[model samples]
Target chain A: MKQGPLDLSQHFLEEGVVDLSSSEKQSALEELCAITSKHAHVRDAKAFCKAIFEREKLVSTGIGLGVAIPHVKIPSVTDYVITVGRSEAGIDFDAIDGQPVRLVFMIAASEKQTAEFVRVLASIVKLVKQNDVRSRLLEASMPNEFCSILREASR
Target chain B: MNARTLVDHIRSSAATGRLLILCVIIGAIAGVFCVAFSWLLETVQYYLLDGLAHHESEHPVWIWLLVLPAFGGLVSGVLTTKFAPEAAGPGTDAAVDAYHHHGGRVRTRVPFIKMITAAVTLGTGGSAGREGPLTQIGGGIGSFVATGLRLSNQERRILMAAGMAAGIGAMFHAPLAGALFAAEILYREMDLEHEVIVPSFIASIIAYSIYAQKAGWEPVYAAPHFHFRNALQLLAYAALAIVLAASATLFTRLWRVVRDAFSSLPVPTALKPAIGGLIAGSIGVFVPDALGTGHHLLAGAFASSFSIGFLILLVTAKMVTTSLTIGSGASGGKLGPSLVLGGSLGSIVGLVVQDLFPSLEIDAGAFVVVGMAGFFAAAANTPISTIIMVSELTGNYQLLVPSMLVCVLAYLFVSRHGIYDAQLVSRLEAPSKMGNMLGAVLKTIAIRDAANHTRDLIVVPEAMSLRQIIDLYTSSEQLAFPMVDPDGKLTGMIEGRDIRRAIAEEGVADLVVARDLARPHEVIDIESTLLDAVQRMTLTGLEDLILVEAEDPTRPVGVLEHQEVLHAYDRKLMEK
Candidate 1:
């Protein structure tokens, strides 16, 4: 089968766009991983958090401008998946820009998905760099609104 | 050229004289190279980045900014690939790998190629630094001098480390730190190359003094004296350490990512650096401060002149551009860029903490300096030397407490894979040290270690006939059996070879008794090491040795197999 760029919007089921409840950085990650654990790609939320946090230790995915992308590659994951978590009151993520992170995009990829992983990483970095996309994502109130914003951005 | 020893070439009577004279000569030579390399780098960097860019400031010189770095990368890539392939990329790896794996012998032309390539790579606005490549250059100087003199491989490796220390010491103007760095950077853990320490110190101090005498003794960055005031504020420093550690991990991982990406590209190796340079130049067109060795950023950080936004931009841009510069196989070091990135992140952390607490009276510039130490400590996996190096770089000993604390915390927190690809986890893990460690470790284990296995021996009665002994040997797997007297006292031993000879004489199989076939055998004392037993077996052509008490050497109590001694060593090696 031929592989192409993943439609990030299509994967964003409204339920996957979680409103982060915790103020602390560790808990915020836990909340995202927990919410997305029900997906087929993520069988265990604890395991997902463990792998992603281990990677975070290697390098924080906190790209500057209030956005963070915590990602991991695990053998248990069958494919690639993206789970979004937004916080109104930003949490300290040790961001390169010294800004508190408000938007956390948690990505889980199968261990075999090397090329797809890079493409997904590039897409996320590029998508957040767009001023309108980032602003709309931050201001996004409802889960449906979040999905639409990503869909429009992906298009 | 094939002269294998210094004595062969020099015809010296005094070996001590030769070693001392060579040590001093290598240090002086390394010192001179450091000054020359620094001069060439400054001249070229000024021509491309500052001198030329400022001269054409009135026009749209952005094109020049883009072209200059790409051109620099192309020249460096071509030079290294054409002449000395080992001279390519961040140089510390080659130097370190040489000491561990290659017997410290650098190719004759690598040093010369590295110097020129590093100069062009760093000077023409590549976001890499001078120090990393300088290690290879200096190490080459040592290797070359030792090769010419025909020094032993061990002595040659020591000189190589000394040269590395000298180059780093001269460039940073931090002699003590450079000396320590030479020892510390070899391993990822908190271990040092103890043998290299004294030699590195001697070379480092000499190199630092010579460079200072020629280039002035001024510290690289000027800063106001910053002291640790509140013990409570160490919490803030800890936070800074975490941030620095995280950023350091980011720097190393991103560096690898970029390098892998560039290497994996289908283009010829000679042209990959140019592509990386083009992208980096485009970034430089907007944020010009991000290019080169980052002295400007270092200066700004020490002056406490950064807004959070500005510092953040510099940090991000510096990380990306520096990665591109070094990752694309352009010959330069990431150490200097790491210092800048760490300081920027630290400066921002300091600002935020000071604003949040207001009463802590936190000095933001202090964090910049501390960040420099902490970040390098984490990324390079050299904590102790980094603390001193940053202190010496800023000429401020007042912040030693904070610097040391931050460095250690960051070092402990960083990932196992640091910026250096060649660093081993410990001295034991290094191949150069393994051969010598084997015998020394085995000697520590006594025969008593395997005392439990002695109880399961097969004892042959002295009264038993040769036929009975032959039947027992055929049924059981014992190669040798302990022969005993009729009174059940241990006497001697009978091996398979003796049994075979006895049985070959036709009627003797039933005629000879166990006592007749028994031969007086070598015995090992309980106090002896496994090495001793094995050595005896090799010398006497014995398959097994009788174990005797050290106090009673006449009486044989149990048997010790050659295989058991070997098994003991195998278990011990695993522990080591």
Candidate 2:
């Protein structure tokens, strides 16, 4: 229910945090969609990937600080969802600061999910704004380590 | 030029070899349907109005006149509101809407429901026209027959127009004008639906012949022989055109205002029409000429017995009563009432002109005919067809020069405001012609050039209460509000749908803030191509409402509306 705050920790699955070997920004989005599409909320993985790429065409969602957050609100996305894909090589995301994106945070929300969608998005904004959050997230070598850092930082 | 030139009106216009045959079949059926509707209208009017109230007689029974239309409105209202709301208001607009938006699809039951309901509304003295109801009815027939034959969407739309032509041609007894009306009425500007012209002609001729065979080949109004020879008469005709243009504008605006007022009432939608009929009936108690479609008054105005003062009063009364009856969700058309309003006003102007030019032998009846054509031409944005339609309806072939001048003048004077709201600006903008939007134009324009710039942007503060946002939503036209944090940095955005969903889900608005309702909104850089924005908009099923920003997308600069992109694209194509 959108009336109450979303439990951020429960939504971040350890398996979803992947060390993505993507050469381009588009490939990075594909890798994240493949992982997120496996979740119960996404109706189709291929369509979701296509939608994310389409959203990227307008303007790069890569906010500064080596973080590219590509998000879409679509009918295919039945609930609030997120997946983290880290490209160690740092793909060029055309960010305003000209920083190569080391971390790709993908968000997918339902067309109708208002409160919970906004809550998840705002939490990500807060998490990305943390002083050392990106460096800590990039340095983590394993998926479980990445999850723990996110969980602890969020708490 | 010798007889009939099978000319290709447009380069891309569909080949009408098989379509012509279908038009013949559809036209025949639509013609018989028109005759049946006319007969039904007359039978009901004779029994109900003549028997119960003595409607047209001198010193008529008053109480019966007041109750009959209200009762008729109650029945017709329930029929349209309960079973077929598509039949509500003017039927011609619904028919045009279906052609342009609904892929030429009309539900199977709409025609049958419309026929019965429209007859009831007109027969019991509701101040509405037969054109709208019959157009929808005939259009439904065409849609049905075309769908049965497994036609394409384009073919179906063509057939639908043919049916419309048949209905108008048969009912108004003006076959050629009816065909032209069907094609011309679909667009507001000087443009016509060129593809529909020939097929409509075929259907209209067939329908008119069949109806004439049964109902006698007489024009609706018989006018005395009147000539327009004097050069001084142009002055009078021009003044008539200007006044008629003004009256047409007034009629269209009045219709919308009255329609909105009735819709805003808390009563059941079905009961609204009954209330409208009650008001019209009360007006009819003093002026019975306004109670029904004012066709008979047009005939009377041309005769010698009717005074100029009475004709002027009839014009005002007809405009008011027709606005009340049809605007309140009753099934009817504006075309028939417009004829009466224009005819009476023209007659009044003609008398005034005759007084001015006492030395010249001038015929006032010529103005009556030209006035009918001119008033409708401006009101409905159908100049060419209305001239021919009015001429044939009056059997007045001698006044073509005056009719043409008046119709064209009135059309130019009124410009774009007309009765049919569904009429598109031009063929380029019609939804039915989506294929005309070349894909190459999309790649030619940039977001910076096409995006809409607004000075009064409504930016919702993240800390602002959701209750405050709701108030903003009510007061402003902005669809998406950009949400800024305490530092005034763009954090997120709240779409119009987000607020609607929150209200639908019954979220506590007082407790939630703008931050709680804002989603991770998509923004486009000013450098993006129109094609890039369009691809995203279509794939995501979102509007062309992406925010435009500078180097940093979060720093919003403008809003890219899809309409502006389309306008730019259309302009580019025009340059080619």
Candidate 3:
């Protein structure tokens, strides 16, 4: 209940992380959104997935460094949330850098929770940019280990 | 003021200060040009008409007076039509149109072409003023200088106005009036282009001084000793205002009538001025006083030598001749004829008032000055310039009170109808003015200030059924609903538009899940500026964008609706 400097690792639950072999951008985004939907915070799975697809039509969220951030700020979110998916084969996301995205961070948050949402996104990007953090994240077998590595690097 | 110091100072100075210095230089150039133009016209007229044959003589060869103006008109028409067609008609209107619509860009050849055309037209006895051509020449110079330097649009517009003011100031030896004329002539209503006033005034003074050095420091006309006399004279001036206003209206209407008549004629467009010149030349030969700028006739009226009947005839003849000359596209101004008509009308009004009220010592000269100002105030919607210009031209500061009163009365009576059709309502209505205003506003504010907090919104679950979603959608006025999974992690969003589309489709009755039709929405960084958010929305064609944390691209914070951006803009405007 107490808000602090936002932690990116807090949003990544065990079920939120998944190994996705999907090559297409839309399917990868849908799988990530589905992973987040299983969390208690995700109130509407259909509405949430639709928002992500609609956002994709505008521009790809693939920010490069083998990372794609498909984010949505919707009224259906009760709190800030993020779903992490790792594809070793790399998904074909139309990123600005043009490299296939190996990591996808599908984030959804309540309309009012901008502070936490922004902080969480900044922490994730900072942690992911570290060569050690990225390599360890890819080597981690489970979502818990991936989240723990993120927590260590973010600190 | 040293040359080296001045150059260094200008290089280090700000844009506005640099522009003022440039205006002074432009004014000097314009002044020299105006004097040269006036001298050219006078010398040509003397050689062609006066020196060739005695204009006052009854010699049969003096019949050339009847054909000279027609020949001049033909030459002027050819010059205007061939090189710079925009130089045709009153040059002030063209200058005005350039400032309002053309970003103050006048063709380089316009000033030269107009000068030649106007000289020929007026030199050969065409009844029009040289003021219009000088104004265009000055404006052209300003446009040239500003364009050469690659100045901003706003700075260029100001310089153009300053150039026009310099021309009028130098031409008539009325620097203050000329400066005001440039600012006032841009609008038909009671509005001034105030930004140009200071630069224009500086330019006018510089130009006036240069012209005075060559032409001597004398007003354009000399008036007899005239006093305000008594309070009773105010009533007479008021009466003169009414007469001038009526005559001004009639003058404009007659000009239009003559022009329309010539336009509809079977003759070639270039030859129309020749025909007009023939009629005007015939009128001039009968009453030579009505020809040219009529400055001498105006001076004669102030001396109180003309009989009442002769003054009336001069007014009618001057009006008709001016209409014929300018209406045929001879490339001269209406200001000189307007002053002539107003002065003659005032002379008549003065005579009648003195005769009717025997006790009142109403000087006819005072009436003449007031009449000149009043008629132009109504006809050209230039009350301030008319008062100052008339007083300056005659060196009669004592007549200011009466001139102001008459000018106001006439200006009010004439309202929106004026001689310059290119004049707009105000600077506020100009496209360039609005663009500058809006651009300045958009630059000051950022997107962070306009964003709303995410805690203020309603969050919907991604598990909600379509029927339940429909019930909630129908119950509330919310346009967008953010979705989350069972573990409370954000997934996507559903908008009212998506729901409507689904309902319109067939075989979708059982497909009620909120996630099935969810679409991606644009995401904006919370740290991004408000202008960036607005630009993104415009670029992506979205009415709303989702705000995310700057550090974490995947995390959503709040929704920034288009209406909210507009509301912020409205608030900023109100503050302004």
Q: Which pairs of residues clash in candidate 1, taking residues 3 or more apart in a chain or in different chains?
A: B6-B150
Which ranges of candidate 1 are over 4 A from the true structure? A1-155, B1-21, B55-60, B447-528, B532-562, B570-576
Grade the docking of candidate 3. incorrect
Q: Quick one: best TM-score, which candidate?
A: 3
Candidate closest to the true structure, highest DockQ: 2
Worst 10 residues of 1 chain B by lDDT: B503-512
Interface RMSD of each: 36.8, 9.6, 16.5
Candidate 1 chain A lDDT trough over 10 residues, lowest sum: A1-10
Write the residue-wise lDDT of candidate 3 on B42-146 in tens digits: 887887756553454445234666887798889888888889888887888899999999999999999999988899888888889988888899999999999
Which parts of model 3 have CA positions greater than 4 angstroms off? A1-155, B1-13, B52-62, B264-267, B436-576
- Tens-place lDDT digits, model 1, residues B1-576: 566686575665465456556656767887888888888998897777767764124443687778888999999999988999888889998899998888889987987899999999878888888998878887888789888888888878888888899889888998899889989989999999988877788888888888888888998776757888889879999999999999999989999999999989999999988988899989988888887888777777766787999999989998999999889999998788888898898899999998998788898989999999999999999999999998889898989999989999999998878999998999989888875676677688888785443666678876576678889888876667887665666766777766665544443343245644566667789778877876788898787888878787656667776677777888987886
User: What's the CA error at residue B199 for candidate 2, in Å?
Assistant: 1.2
Q: Score the docking of each candidate (DockQ).
A: 0.00, 0.11, 0.02
Q: What ranking emerges by DockQ with the best candidate at the front?
A: 2, 3, 1
